[model samples]
Target: MTAAGMRARGNVRTLVLAGALVTVTAALGMVGCTLFQSEQVSKGQKLYAHYCMHCHGEHGQQNEGYNWGQMPDPRPKDLSNKGEMSTFKDEEIFGTISRDMKDTTPEVGDKIGDDEFAVPTMPTFKYTLSEEEIWSIVAYVRTLHGMKLTYNVEARKKELQDQLQTAQQKADQAKQALEAADKKAEDEAEKKGVEVDEAATAKEQEANVAAIKELEAGKTAFANFTARPKLAAVPRPDLTMAETEAAKLAETGKRLYGNKYGCNACHRVGEAGGLVGPALDRAGFRLNGTWVYRWIKYPQSMKPETRMPNLGISDQDAKAITMYLATLRAPKPEKPIEKAAH
Candidate 1:
């Protein structure tokens, strides 16, 4: 073969090798992205189980007993409903999760001070979770409506930038308004030959200052924004116990009912407890053991209108509580009191 031909063949081989390397790199990058997203979803699942599953259910739908009579928006949102979930954007969901709808700025309207909905049932989580943790929850919630788990870092950055820009604009406009008000007031005072009241726009001045501070904070948040890393998975509670372990389980249940879970706050074990719920001293006689277990584990599932909030009780704890309650058999009434004579 000619020397030039041999050199040409070598060049073709080099190009093929380069293309293969590029393909392999692209594939690895895709795999890494997939793994990261999976981890985020896994973390989100753990969070949802711990914080949301009781109200939202094991799935995003409400628990089995769907009847929540008389309460406004009667039942918790059916998050698994694709059509309903489709109406909300990811950011809107994040905001809803983080803020109390009634008190959050811009979202408030005629409903803000309504007597009927004065206290929102959904609690605000802004104080409890970091921004990344909230975002992770949002990612997991998307899956309920059949969306993929994704964290669009660039998109979120743009949102932060837009928010910062809006805040800055509001701050500027407030400053200008305050300055204009002051100038007008000064001019009027000068024309009238009276002293200007420096405190005339005191409230407006305070509002302007607040707006400026908000703008500065927004800027800082935007500057520091970055993609959240995957969180460590939360451990699941152990629910395993042998059938013969009744005595020990009941002892644990006694501690949980009185101390750990605060069951006594609403229930009465004897003359010593609250009157909000029926006395449980005769729970063993009045209620079935199996029924007690189910009720404790998922209160809403049995009676949607019940005020008892599911405390995310584990199966083991529920069983223990049931056993403990079973031990509370009040001595049989000596004799049923005769009905009062009419």
Candidate 2:
């Protein structure tokens, strides 16, 4: 072969190899992006259900149960509105969702109040979620609005960690300042030949303690939020009932108690339940079936300001639940010991 021909063939081979490498890299990049997006959207859907759907509606239509009566005045924004969502940038949506009342610059000597209201106008997820998680929610929101936005999962995670660290630093500084102020107040009272207001001092100390506790709780909650621990499956409660017509109904009530009614979420029956409501350790001894039935059916009729929501319990379900509850009786008290007369 001629030298010129050999050189030409070598040049063509080099170009072909480079082209293949480029193609493979581009394909791999595309695959990675697709996978990342899919995972984020899935996370976003779960987060939305857990957080946003209560106010925004299931499908973002603002037609949910809460939107009608439970939500505050100037009801939650209609996220389903394509035109309205179109105006805001992705960052703007994120800011709106995560911004808290205390994000503003505090005046000199003003403490950052960490206590969130029982029911906020628009609750901030900054305390609950990291930046990555919030962006995942944003990505999901985009899907609802019929748009595809790119999300960088790793970069957002780093940003979120940095933000959390900054918040911790601020909390630490606030706590230290409060401690110093409390000590200074005590010292000043001692130096001054005046009576110290014990009540006011005690109240101030209580506030400082609460602030410290809240900060610690916030850190623990955020850690748990990031961990995303798997929830344990609930075991069926073994309920005992007397041999009566109501007892027959209690069987169905037992299932309803554990599953649909979500009574177990608040009321503790045994080892497994929340502490939101009074434990039914011996509810039967305290009240009769008739009263229990009325309370279950129309709780508001009895106490207007009850924390328990009117679940619109059907007559049969309420009766069944009442029967089941009536079976619960407190243990008999033991006799007290007599003291010897001196």
Candidate 3:
């Protein structure tokens, strides 16, 4: 009950508090690391079946029925080649799934346009799946080969850069051809001794020069126009494999077509992505969910004559995708085109 007794009690309480803090820290760490390996493996299976299995077969050996094998000379690689699967790290595989060869959104002409916009080349699923889902796919891939394959991303990047250079070269050739044609026309005008409007001709020459310069700019974007446009995105947490999961899958599937899976890459759902394929703005007016699921799973199998490539989706992914496609209703009547100002 004196000063020394009070000081001794305070010291004991400090030690108790420190011990509890240490205990809590260790528990939190264990939870963070627990079963991480298996979780990653499960995620990989989902990604593989959804994105790789069609060509790789059920077990990832390899097959030809899927579009990957349907080439004039199908060369689907054997993923079991520990060397091949090991070639990519988790991050690299995720990068590949994010974009297509050219990173261009596919487009086909519209009913309203004199012609349709070009659809993106490869379907972009970047928006459909989360960063975690995508990253998990990479982690799962790492488990395959056992021998950790370091993805030579620098080399792949260089290859992409080379493709870009090749595209630029083609554009340069096109500009040269345009200039040659323009020169020929100007020469003809001079031949006729027509009093040329020097000012207008100068203006045209400058405009041509500017346009040729703009071709160097890789892709055009309307970033300034669509800032924070409230696009619908699929919320997770309800994705557990449960009864309500089916309804949630349908909601997620529809979101993918609109904002995630990049189905809008080719198929325009009226107000959705560019016209790379037939407008599905009203797919419901034409087909059913069974057909959509079957097509999403194996498009070429059903329509061997069609050019629509397989998305390499899994049963669950297909379900989610089909659910969204089912939402496609016929487009409203086309609006009247506005005339240009005189």
Candidate 4:
């Protein structure tokens, strides 16, 4: 063979090998991508196996109370019906697992804003896993079946969007209607020659000013005057962590909570108080101390229209309060928060 022919043959052999190698690498890369995204059911199941399976049951059929945590049902929610759960959109189920429904507000049913979980035992998982991991868990949970749901989320969102549009249109119409009515009223007033009696108006104004002054006088807690709450003391609103007490801060807390703050006016310690607030013997166990502290520091912050007046507690005072309450840990576990009155 000629020298050129030999070199050409070698070059073709090298090109063929390189092409085969490239094809092999591409095939492996595609396989790797597929595994990474592979609907991830197993990865999800494994994640659930690590975090949820113990209480939720191996197959989600376990019905047992918590060992350390106190729960009314003790048993975790069962999530085994495809037909039933099919009603929930991926978003809601994702919510249940990821959002820690217990951390949710009790009045509204499962709000993170509430003390993290209405069910005292459930821990909030907000910090533990990523969103993708949570979604994968939701997909795995979908495999479980039985409870019925009313509406899938996509449908609900659409329904809500439609309702919002309708409401906006109605609001616009009502505003226009109100403007027309107000214009008519003004026109009628002008025609009627509306007039005021100055002497009578002056008397009415004086009466209103006197009444406001009386109200103001009633609210002021003057030194040495022992201002009485016009309304009888109310049941304290659910307090925040700032509202509670812990061990270390108990000494100063005893003084402030008892005397200056007048907490004992409603709350009781050892037989030296009133029945307005819940007994504080085991306050720490009753509600999470953290929540109590929050309640104390800013009770009204939790429920804007709450009966409890803002006590104007400072942050330092709140910390001391939590420290004292921690000293009030229950000798034993409290009975599961009574199906907490809705």
The TM-score leader among the candidates is 1
Q: Per-candidate TM vs. native?
A: 0.44, 0.43, 0.32, 0.33
Q: Model 2 over residues 263-334: C-alpha lDDT tens digits?
A: 654465654443445777677788776667767765655665454544545676777888788778857436
**Between candidates 1 and 4, which one is better according to TM-score?**
1
Mark the 10 consecutive residues where model 4 has the least summed lDDT. Answer: 221-230
Best of the candidates, lDDT: 1
Model 1 agreement with the true structure over 1-342: per-residue lDDT tens digits: 999999999999999999999999999989987886778778878877765654565668754222212122334688888898887777778777665424222342224543323224454445345566677788888898898644574467688989999999999999998999899889999999999987888877998999999999897676444432222222333445666687788887887675445565446565444333466888878897777777776665666545555555566667788888978988865654232121
lDDT tens string, model 3, 45-106? 78766655544445556553243333222234565578776655555556665543221223
Model 3: lowest-lDDT 10 consecutive positions: 220-229
Indicate whether candidate 1 or candidate 3 has the larger TM-score.
Answer: 1
- Segments in model 1 whose C-alpha atoms lie over 4 Å from true places: 64-72, 103-119, 154-342
Better of 2 and 4 by lDDT: 2
Our model 1 lands, by Cα RMSD against the true structure, at 17.1
Sorting all predicted structures by lDDT, with the top scorer first, yields 1, 2, 3, 4
Model 4: CA > 4 A from native: 1-39, 64-70, 100-122, 145-325, 328-342
Q: Model 4, clash count?
A: 42
Clash pairs of candidate 1? none
lDDT of each: 0.66, 0.62, 0.52, 0.52
Q: After superposition, how far is residue 29 of candidate 4 from its true place, in Å?
A: 12
